[model samples]
Every structure is written in structure tokens, then in C-alpha cells.
Target: MFAGAVRVGTIDRVGIALSGLCVVHCLTSAIMLAVLASAGGILVDHRIHAIGLVLAIVLGMVALGRGIVEHGFMMPAAIGGLGLGVMAGALTLPHDSGEVVYTIVGVAILALGHDLNRRAVV
Candidate 1:
């Protein structure tokens, strides 16, 4: 049981880190798009967002699923699910529109969910 808890904690941390990376990628890509438009092809790639969202979904679900089992709480999973939904919604928007804002907000919420899950585990 201790080992499983530790693994869950580790997964939560990874989820947080991934969320931070997603935020950084969104912000950096926006800045890069504004400054050096040539870099937009790589930085603003839609595939990157898709891949990141997939990762976020997987990590969030696994970590939060374990958290609910161990901690017997639903907030973390609910928050994380909301975040994932927001992220998925962002994908429907045009890249040049409010996508970045939605992505950042979703990532931040997801990171918060991860932090909450970690705290509950501890």
C-alpha cells in the first residue's frame, strides 16, 4: 500500500510538471509568434497541443483516479476533469484566437488539481 501511494504521488508530480510545461509552451509559442513568425511552424504546431492534451488526460485520469481510491475524495478528479474539458474545448478554436488563453487557464487548473491530489495523498 505504501508503494502504491508513493507511485501515485510521483504520478501527481509528473502531472503537475506536464501542466507547467503546457503553460510554458503556450506562452512561449505566443511570444514567438509575435516576435519571430518564422518559428511559428514548429512552436504553434497543432500536433503539439493534441499530444500535450492526450498526455494531460492520461496523467490526470490516472493520478486522480488513484487519489480518489486512496483518499476517498472527488474534488481533485472533478477539477482535473474540468481542466481537461477546457483543454479539449480549446482545440476547437482557431490557433490565432483565444486558444492560448484557454490552454493556459486549463493548464493552471490542472496543475492545481495535481497539487491537491498530492496533498491528499500525503
Candidate 2:
């Protein structure tokens, strides 16, 4: 799906877009759950979070890994790895136990890493 973007060195941009989507999903889920009691099942599904995290990890690894290889720098990949770890940790939190906060922070960090990766490449 993102072949063209990746080939054109826009992987970081794609990662940033995914990070934005993750943030939107997190906020929307929180709002939906608060506003509609019946929205819990769909919005709070663990599978969704798991899938999102996996996507982030794969994209981060690819983009940051390539960035490090090209620029001979590891900071972007390190930061991305740390962000992925935080996001994974969020999954371990109990419901209503500040999971959203962790996820959002992780996503933000991940986006920053992608931005750094882009800069390194340039």
C-alpha cells in the first residue's frame, strides 16, 4: 500500500501520518466511550490497539532502520524503539488506568523519532 511512498524516501512522512491517525483514534475512542456507554465494545477493543501497535512497530523499524543505515546515526532508531516499548507497555495497563496517556505519549515520541529520521536523511 505504501510502496511508492517508501521507495521515494517518504517513509518518515508515512510514519508521521500514522502517528497522527493513532492520536486521533485514541482521542476519539476516549470521547466516544465517555459520551456513549454502548460504544465501549468497539472503541475499547484490545485488538484494535494491538494492530495499531504492530503497525507502528513495523513502520518504525523500517523507516528508522533505513535512516540509521543511510545516515550512520542511531538516535532515531533508539528513540523509535523506546517509543515502541512505551506503547507496548500501555497494553499491560488495566482499563481506566491511564493507558490512553501512555499511548499518546508513545505516539508523540514515535512521531518525533520519525521527524528526526527525516532530518538525518536530509
Candidate 3:
């Protein structure tokens, strides 16, 4: 019903959806990280975080795989979509003014990764 109410070809619905998704994404990421930190900091170890990073990247690629199978040779844009979300959360985590430099670097790397993924689509 809600989906049907959304008009096609109008930015109205898309903008609302994106905004809502972003709000939820931010809240969920914050809560998850907090829980991880409080519960013995599951992500504290550099080696474990490295593994998690690899897993996250793989999941993004898997999303692309699913998209490729569904679209059948169309632009597999899933990786960029996922990478953008990851970067968005990562950038906000530090919150400290001094971390702005690191956030900029993360965003730049994210853009580069997204661009590479998008370009590689066949």
C-alpha cells in the first residue's frame, strides 16, 4: 500500500525513502558499534577488524553478483551503493574535529573504490 502510494518519476518519494533509510542506517550503525565496544570490543583487534573489512567488501561484491544475475548484463551498481553506505557510517564514527582529515581520506578512498567498481561493470 505504501509502495503503491509512491508516485513513479517523482523525486518526492525517492527523497523521502532515501532520507528515512539514512536515518535508520545511522542509528543502527551507532548502536551496533556501541554494543561491540561495550561487549568486549569485538572490533578492537586490528587483525579481526581487517577480517571484518574483507568480509564487508565481499558482501558488497556479493550484492553486485546478485544484481548482475537479476539484471543480466546491465550495470552492476550494487557495490557502489553498499560502499557508499559503509563510508557514510565510517565517516561519522569519529565525530571529533581532528578526525575530519581521516574522514576526508575515507570518503576519497570510498569514491575511488566505488568508481572502480562502477567502471568494471560489463
lDDT of 3 by residue, 1-122 (tens): 22233232122223224334444544444456566656433433334434544544554454444435433443434434544455445544554323333433433443444344334434
Per-prediction backbone clash count: 0, 0, 0
Model 1: per-residue Cα lDDT over 75-105, one tens digit each: 9899989899999999999997499999888
Score candidate 1 by TM-score against the native.
0.91
Error of 2 at 122 (Å): 2.7
Q: Measured by TM-score, how close is model 3 to the native structure?
A: 0.32
Clashing pairs in 3: none
Top model number, TM-score: 1
Pairs with steric clashes in candidate 2? none
- The local distance difference test score of each candidate is 0.86, 0.85, 0.41
- List, residue by residue over 61-116, the lDDT tens digit for candidate 2: 88988887777789988998889999999999965539989999999999999998
Q: What is the lDDT of residue 8 in candidate 2?
A: 39
List candidate 3 stretches off by more than 4 Å: 1-42, 72-122
lDDT, ranked from best to worst:
1, 2, 3
Off by over 4 Å in 1: 1-8
